[model samples]
Target: PRLLRAAGVAQVVPPLAARDGRLHVPLCRQAGGLQLAVFAYITGRGGADAPLGREQWRQFGATLRAVHQTPVPEPLRRALPTWQEPGEVGRWLQRALPVWRRQKGRTAAARALIEVIGVRYDELQALTARMLALHQRLGERIAAGELRCALCHSDAHVHNLMVDQQERVWLIDWDGASWSPIERDLMFVIGGLSADLLRPHETEWFFEGYGPVQIDWPALATCRYAWAVTDVHAFAIEALGERDEARASSSAAWFERLFAPGEIVALAREGEAWL
Candidate 1:
């Protein structure tokens, strides 16, 4: 908060301090000695389900660029985590294996999910492999310095953004903030929210404000697929683990919209077209 203020970034919600000039204070002083901090109130309504207007979308790009461009304090820079660090790429592949396994007995449930989603078992397998392959290719580029990392709000999405009464935009939800390829943030909005809102123009507006920056197409595609697949697969796995047939089916149907044949590929192509 202090650093951004010093850098002249506008519409940021800084933490409030208590009487003792401490930024963090006890959370009710009873919840297991938990701590919390107060933040300035942002008066606006809209979320992942309800998106802000087009103009606001452009402002979102500008604000995001401001955040990424803010000079990182040396200590904070050293502490932040990055994408594809160590075994991170392998972890994504490991989590997605169940989606490609054979269906027999307990596995039948996962297979039935593939059937219900209108996707063939083989198609799901191909998608998983494609996502993993993209991850590997991008991972190599990341190692070779073709793609650069920056301070990113890893969970940046419409739901984490706010447009106050004055029409100023604010981005919240700092928990996942990290030093990562900026595409980590770009993929969520472009891949997930854009799917629901059908707002392709919003992305153009965003880029207009964000200015010019290299877009690693493969890396962006990897992020888009990996995020969706991991999330939907986790949802399905949880429901199956609990033996909640209805929820499991619901998750399957939900995931279908994301991974149905040609859907993700089309999304990736669309994003690349603009880039």
Candidate 2:
């Protein structure tokens, strides 16, 4: 509490109503006796339905850069851990994988995801295995070198990022916060933006000041493909346990379209060829 106060966030905004996750809130101050609002990042004004624009994402990148400028005090820094640390991804994976691995497609909720996977069994299988391997291997790079350590929002998708009433970019959802490779942000931002089925270079606006990541292209491409599998599974998990069969199918369709193979070889080799 003292640390938060010291950081100038006298009071956090009242947490907004969230279904899956909400990133903005209202707040007040005690010492100053001021009623004000605060945000974890730029909160967009788009209601529940609209997505962010390309320029919006460019600003998001800028805000993310600004966040990097604020040196985290020792206590906070120590308190935060890399997302790559053990027990982190594993936990999310545990809850989600069961729904993903189910074959019978009996779980009415997972029908969409199962259908997506069912169509590309051989490809999805290879991709999933490769991604798991990379995570197992490169996760060590984080501990050893802290190569791309930054305060990552962790969940960098469109839903978490909102432009508030003032049109300032705010990244919400600290629940996924961690120190990690810059690519984590990329995975959410660039990787996610790709889901819109836009051309790869179309994202140049968002990449302006962003630095390069120390990525194994083949590895990342492999991981990217792996991520498609994982993300679809995640959506499936979220959609599962629900009574809405139509919505579940909708969920699966979203996964299928987003995770389709565009050019794995090209994406894998986007940087240096994977070793």
Candidate 3:
């Protein structure tokens, strides 16, 4: 809350489900709305794929840049868990594997999932083991000059954003927020934005608006596909009546996408770049 003032937001109001990755608040007049900045919900079914206005998305990205630029207050930093630590990522992946395994036998599609994911239980176990190993390896790289990091709105897509009647886009969920390769945010929003909501040319313009930064679509494509797997995991878990478990496992799949190279290369070539 205190950290937000540093970010220029007036306040961080409490919501009924704040801990559950959502915020529902009556809009303050300055919020420029009818009195709510609720967590976005996909209207009419396809869930996260639902419509998010184009102007709203562009504004959302801009808002995120501002939010990311905000400094963390000492007290708030003390009060909150430090996200993006290697230990945290490792813990998250470990915790999520069990959840994924639990659903293994339950989902009729579990077998199909195993095939699509290119892993069996043992395989996933080994892969996750390797992921932890690589986590250690990447930690070394990140600590050295090899990698650059930035705070990211892990769920950078438009669905997690809401624009009031004023058209001021507000970012909602922070469940997956972390410090990662700066490209995580770019690849995420770019890859996941739907055909109806986004087009490649528009996305190019969007990235151009990010000011000055490299836009390697192939690399971004890598991150995007990894995110896609997680998206599928999220949808399936929510459908399976296990929302919390879903979020964790699905998010793991997302991380796995980053670590797993074959998937990334394939996604880049596949033009996971949809409209």
Candidate 4:
């Protein structure tokens, strides 16, 4: 956050410091045992479902460009983790599939998992395999030092973006920040990866603010598939592991939505053509 502010990324809402002078002070735990932290509040209107106008999309593009262009200090560079291919979905499925197959589906969570995975397991496995292969190719490129790394907001989806009263586009959620290929951020913009939030012309307007640059197609494809794979893994975990029924239902719904026509799964598969 400090680095973004220093780089003139005014869209970032500065966190309020706690009594101990720490910005992200951990507070009480939620029912799910997740630690809650407080931060500076911004008066904004946009949310995950908010429709962004052309200007808003352009500003979002510019703000993200600023974030990617921010220089990483030596200490920060060393501390930040580099991008890696996602494998949790594959691993989790490998371990859970056999168990799920054998279970009588007595528990609600077990039933939910079985119902979600039973029909789509093969499709999920095939997609994961394709993504893993793409990642392997990406790994070779990384080893050959063919890609450039930048500060990236790895989860820069619509939910993480907001528009203030002055129409400034604010980027929230920094927990997923990492040193990754610029494509890590770009993938969410160019493809339908923004969940179809930005129209085709709006995407062009976004590039107007972002300016010209060469796109690393291989890196972009990997990032896109990685996001899909990671989301699948995360939602499946929430559906099967979350004790709260409401949360579990929400996860299951999102997991189902991922496979809807022209949704994330199809979008990710479309990325293979770029390879």
Candidate 5:
């Protein structure tokens, strides 16, 4: 939040101190000073329901570019989280795969869901393998100092971006903020969830305002694939935890959309062509 403020980004509104310059205040459970949990209010406009226009998308891209260009303070370098050393999706699936296998064996319902997942298992594995390769390239480039790393909003999907009344684009929810390749941000808007909503010329306008920066296409492709698959994978896992038929059914629908015939294969071919 301080970084955005320093970068002259007026869109971000961080939490303020309740009193004594404390950003969070605790609620007493019984008497006083129990320190159960601290809380702060964040102000922002728009939400998942908000509809965005072309200009907003351009501004969104500009805002992200502004963030990426902002230098990380030396004091905060070690404190801030980083990415592309290992892809987040890879790590998440690593943990999830074992749990999923266990669930499938123990629960008959999980077995039913597993059958649905199995239909696309080969494609999922294929996408995961390609993304892993891209992650390797990203790691090599970062390690060799061939790639310039900067602050990225790892979850910069449309739902997280808020548009104010003045039409200014506000970037909220810094939970996934990390020091990573710029492609991580770009792919979120271009090839991730928001991709389907963007018109072709609007995409061009985004780049126009964002200025010319070379993208590691392989890395971007990896991120793009990871973004889509991670949502479906996470949601499917959540559905199992929910034990609700509606949510589990919805998860299956998303899995189908994510693994649409030839989609992952096409993305793999395109990414390979860039290499």
Candidate 6:
């Protein structure tokens, strides 16, 4: 939050420090074993349900560009992690495929996901293989110093954006911040991952605020494919590996949506042509 504020981002909810002057505090293990933290609440309205107007979308684009362009000081840069190959999907495929093949689901949602997997298993396998291959190639390029890296708000979806009372757009959710290809964020905006948020024609307004950008298609394709694979792994875990009925039901719905006609899986497949 301080980094973005220093960069002159329109707005950011600064994190409040704890008694020790640390912004993040640890929670009890029973409470999920995650860190606890709080931020200065912004008086704004924003969420997945609150669709942005074209101008607001443009502002969001500019805000993201500012984040990407912010320089990381040497000490902080050394501490921040660079993007790594996504592994959850491969792990899920290894562990879950056998159970799915046997149709040994423990819950209704699990059964539904298993049934869908039974029908589309080969397609899923092929896509995972392709995504892994793309990531390998990108890694080679990065090693050869052919790709540029930048600070990224890696999960800059509509749900993480806010529109303040002053009409300025604020970016929230810095937990996923990392050093990555700029395409890591751009994939959501101009690269079809955000079809639910901005139509293709309306993306021009975003560019209007962002100015001209030279897109690296291969990098964008990798990001899109990785996103689909990661999302599938996440929802599958909830649907098949958890006992919460309501959460499982929601996960099952989201898992099905990933393969819907115009959804993330399809978008990732469409991106394969860019490679």
Q: What is the lDDT of candidate 1?
A: 0.66
Full ranking by TM-score: 6, 4, 5, 1, 2, 3
- Candidate 2 lDDT tens digits, 13-58: 2243345454333354443564333434434363124645666656
Query: If scored against the real structure, what TM-score would every candidate get?
Result: 0.73, 0.62, 0.53, 0.87, 0.80, 0.91
**Candidate 3: C-alpha lDDT:** 0.49
Candidate 5 vs. true structure, TM-score? 0.80
1-275, model 1: which lDDT tens digit per residue? 54665687775677887899997888885699888988887767655546567777778888888888889988988988767542354465455555544333234454576454334445555655666666677768878998888888877777787777787678787766778778887776565534555367777777787788876666676777666555555655654454555665566565556554446445654554433
What are the Cα lDDT values of the candidates?
A: 0.66, 0.52, 0.49, 0.76, 0.66, 0.80
Which portions of model 1 show Cα errors greater than 4 Å?
A: 18-35, 47-51, 85-122, 188-193, 241-253, 260-275
Of candidates 6 and 3, the better by lDDT: 6
- For model 5, how does the per-residue alpha-carbon lDDT over 214-236 read when each residue is reduced to its tens digit? 87877677666666556656766
Report the poorest 10 consecutive residues by lDDT, candidate 4.
25-34
In model 1, what are the clashing residue pairs, if there are any?
none
Candidate 1 TM-score to native: 0.73
Number of the top candidate by lDDT? 6
Instruction: Report model 4's TM-score to 2 decimal places.
Output: 0.87
Give the C-alpha lDDT of model 5.
0.66
lDDT of 6 by residue, 1-275 (tens): 77778778755677888998998887987888799888877787974657677888788778888888888898887777666736445556656665665766778878878888888788878877787888888888888999999998888877888888877778899887878899998887765664676577557767777778898899999988888888877788778886777788899899889988778998998987899
Q: Write the per-residue lDDT of candidate 4 for residues 1-275, one digit (tens) a residue.
A: 87789778887876666788766644555555554567677787754567777788878888888988888899988888667636545566556665654554434764766776877778877777877777777778877899888899887767788877887788899887888888988877777564555457867877887888899988898888888887887777677776677777787788888888767787887887888
Instruction: Estimate the TM-score for candidate 3.
Output: 0.53
List the candidate 5 regions with Cα displacement exceeding 4 Å.
25-51, 85-88, 91-111, 261-270
Residue 59, model 5: Cα distance from true site in angstroms? 2.1
